[model samples]
Target: MLKVIYILLCILGTFLPYSQFLPFVLEHGFDIRLFFEQLFANRISGFFGMDVIISSLVLWVFVFWEGTRLKMQNLWVYIASNLLVGVSLGLPLFLLMRQFQLEQQTDTAIS
Candidate 1:
């Protein structure tokens, strides 16, 4: 059930942002320059973008530590999801995978 929720959130995170970006990209010819131009277009947007970037850096460190500590096989997948989607999806998706990993460890220990 929790996994399902995480997956749904991932879908939402991907589609909702893509829906906005796709149209813009199509209209503007997919220029990375323009994308950054708009990203830092104003003080508010610059702050938001910087916040996401800094937070993402912190997230990457945690993902690296926890992924190694837990021996998570799909750590790359989590990183890709964060890159392709957003932290809103990737963080919870990693958590969902972590939950499954913990459950497996518990089951094995119990057995």
Candidate 2:
């Protein structure tokens, strides 16, 4: 059930953001300058932009620290997810993997 929720979240995370972003890319063809211009064009947008930047940084730290503590392999996949989609995809994806790892550990211990 938890895994199912995480999977749903991963789908939402990717689809929701890209639903907005894909059209921008199609219209603008990856205009970095214009993107930044619009991103920080106002205080409200700037707030969200700064928040996401900080959130990404924090996610990296958590991924490195907790992921290594759990001995989770392919940690780069989480980072790549973050880079490609944002926290929406990255966080739920990590949690899904973490849950799997935890279940595996419990099974091993029980055995």
Candidate 3:
């Protein structure tokens, strides 16, 4: 359940860039007025890069939380890896934790 929510969040995070780009693309497609309206209506789009950074940080926190919750053997390793990837990739880290949760769930179910 939580894993599913994380997966969905990851999917939504991946789509964020596209959502930000939509207004620009719409303007290029010659709907300038509508584009500006849509763009400003969602003021957050004006700070897409910042939004991505914040989202990445939030994702990293989620990863850390999950790692600590599961008490995995290499919890620090996972945390460090997620921190590095989160900073370097400038992308949300939710996918990594989501994958971990899915694997953990599967392993438990199998046992």
Whole-model lDDT per candidate: 0.83, 0.96, 0.56
**Which segments of model 1 are wrong by more than 4 Å?**
none
Query: Candidate 1 on 1-111: residue-level lDDT in tens?
Result: 888887887778778878987898889987989989999999999999899788777778888898888888868887887787677767877888888888898899999
Pairs in steric clash, model 2: none
Which pairs, if any, clash in model 1? none
Residue-pair clashes per prediction, in order, are 0, 0, 0
Candidate 3 per-residue lDDT over residues 43-65, each given as its tens digit = 58657645646765775676567
Q: How many pairs of residues collide in model 1? A: 0
Q: Report the lDDT tens digits of candidate 2 across residue range 38-83.
A: 9999999999999999999999999999999999999999999999
- Candidate 3 Cα misplacement greater than 4 A, ranges: 1-46, 73-102
Ranking by lDDT: 2, 1, 3
Runs in model 2 deviating more than 4 A are none
- Among these predicted structures, which one has the highest TM-score? 2
Instruction: Please give the distance, in angstroms, between residue 52's alpha carbon in candidate 3 and its true position after superposition.
Output: 1.2
Q: Which candidate, 1 or 3, has the higher lDDT?
A: 1
Q: What is the lDDT of residue 76 in candidate 2?
A: 98
lDDT of 3 at 63: 57
Q: What order do you get sorting by TM-score, best first? A: 2, 1, 3
